[model samples]
Target: MLNVDGKVVVLTGASSGIGEATAKVLANNGAKVVLAARREERLRDLKSNIDKQGGTAVFKVTDVTSHEEVDELASFANDTFGQIDVLINNAGIMPLSFLHEKKIAEWDQMIDVNMKGVLYGIGAVLPYMRIRKQGHIINVSSVTGHIVNKSWAVYSGTKFAVRAITEALRQEEAKNNIRTTIISPGAVVTELANIITNKEIKKGIEESMKISLPAEAIAHSILYAISQPDNTAVNEIIVRPTNQEI
Candidate 1:
């Protein structure tokens, strides 16, 4: 039997892309999924699909940028499922632009969603995991986290921060028996590119995505991380399309 069977997973950013794929994959493997995202309609649709397929899932409309909402999401998941075995900090945004463009709002949004949102998720789940001395926290970073590129300064900064934070959490919580994993994915064809305000960059990204991996590729990486045994920790995974050089 898969280790993911019977685990209660709280997944954020689950309205689309990697989050959505991960939620379905885990649910199909017998996980009790708690989907979190800002779009209630999408969440409901996802839950309905999962239910139709004989997978257990529920959803909470949540904005990860707000600590209060994240807290409530954690509470709701625990209240509904009895405990949260896994928390996937998957809410993030990438509004790529040159620093010279000075798109401060986009930068702020990225920080709030990518960096602080992950922090809030960690904060919300730590107490419960610590008390149980057992849990898994999977954070979604990016290829930009390891290799910075043009127009990716702010987005890369947030992703780098994710790796840093996940590493620290791993070190700090080893005694608590909590597992931490950071998934850094390369270009996958997803809605993330739609957020780019820079038309030129967006065009280039779309062009480059001609050979990108599917969101399910990254979702399977997450499933692999979650399927590890209690004594093993698959700490980090960087998955890119075979054609992606960077």
Candidate 2:
């Protein structure tokens, strides 16, 4: 076993979806998880659920768009768990729209949460990791990043930035014994689809959801990467349901 016992993990977007599942998975595997999200009730529910299953967890109300909020989340994790061994920058928003429609508000939200949010997460946790000389960061990208789609222009751009940032961080942090991994998932069934504003796009996404996957599959991939030996940095993982053509 790679032995993640008692490792403190700082997780953003922990109220639902992949972040929520990963929190549970890592805690069940003996990691002390600090959860962050904008939804207080959801975070509390997730913490309660984890506790019911005998896993350790704490939640901080956070909006990843704010640097101070992200910094506070990291500080809270350190205060609660003594040190952070991992930071999962899993917070994101996907409000898909065509360029002609010009959903500027949606575009701005995606840019803030998807791109700058990840950057804020790095800013918050990098200092602590550098000080400790050990850490792991997992950035959640999307298959849209690797392969562009019609309405996903902005979302794909953000994820591509995530992948590029993750790779750069991995190479730069290697000397410090810090590892970075980027996870790109395709069409997994989650609340992400609900964010699409275009009616036609939303309809297409709902249909695509039929061929999507369970969140646990992504959690399993995350566990697989986290459980690898320290010397082995599994830098990127892309997963999609076998039935998902895109």
Measured on C-alpha atoms, candidate 1 has an lDDT of 0.95
Over 4 Å off in model 1, which ranges?
A: none
Tell me, by lDDT, which candidate is best. Answer: 1
CA lDDT, every prediction?
0.95, 0.89
lDDT, model 1, position 3 = 93
TM-score of model 2 (CA atoms): 0.98
Task: Give the per-residue lDDT of model 2 (tens digit) for 1-246.
Answer: 345778888888888889899899988998899999999999999999999999999999999999999999999998888898888899998888999999999999999999999999998999999998988999999998899989989999999999999999988999989988899999787899887878999999998888888887898888888788878888999999997776
- Poorest 10 consecutive residues by lDDT, candidate 1: 189-198
**What TM-score does prediction 1 earn?**
0.99
Distance from true location, Cα of 12 in model 1, Å: 0.3
Predicted candidate 1 versus true structure: per-residue lDDT over 51-99, tens digit per residue:
9999999999999999999999999999999898999999998889999
Poorly placed runs, candidate 2 (over 4 Å) = none
Clashes of 1: 0
C-alpha lDDT of residue 56 in model 2: 96
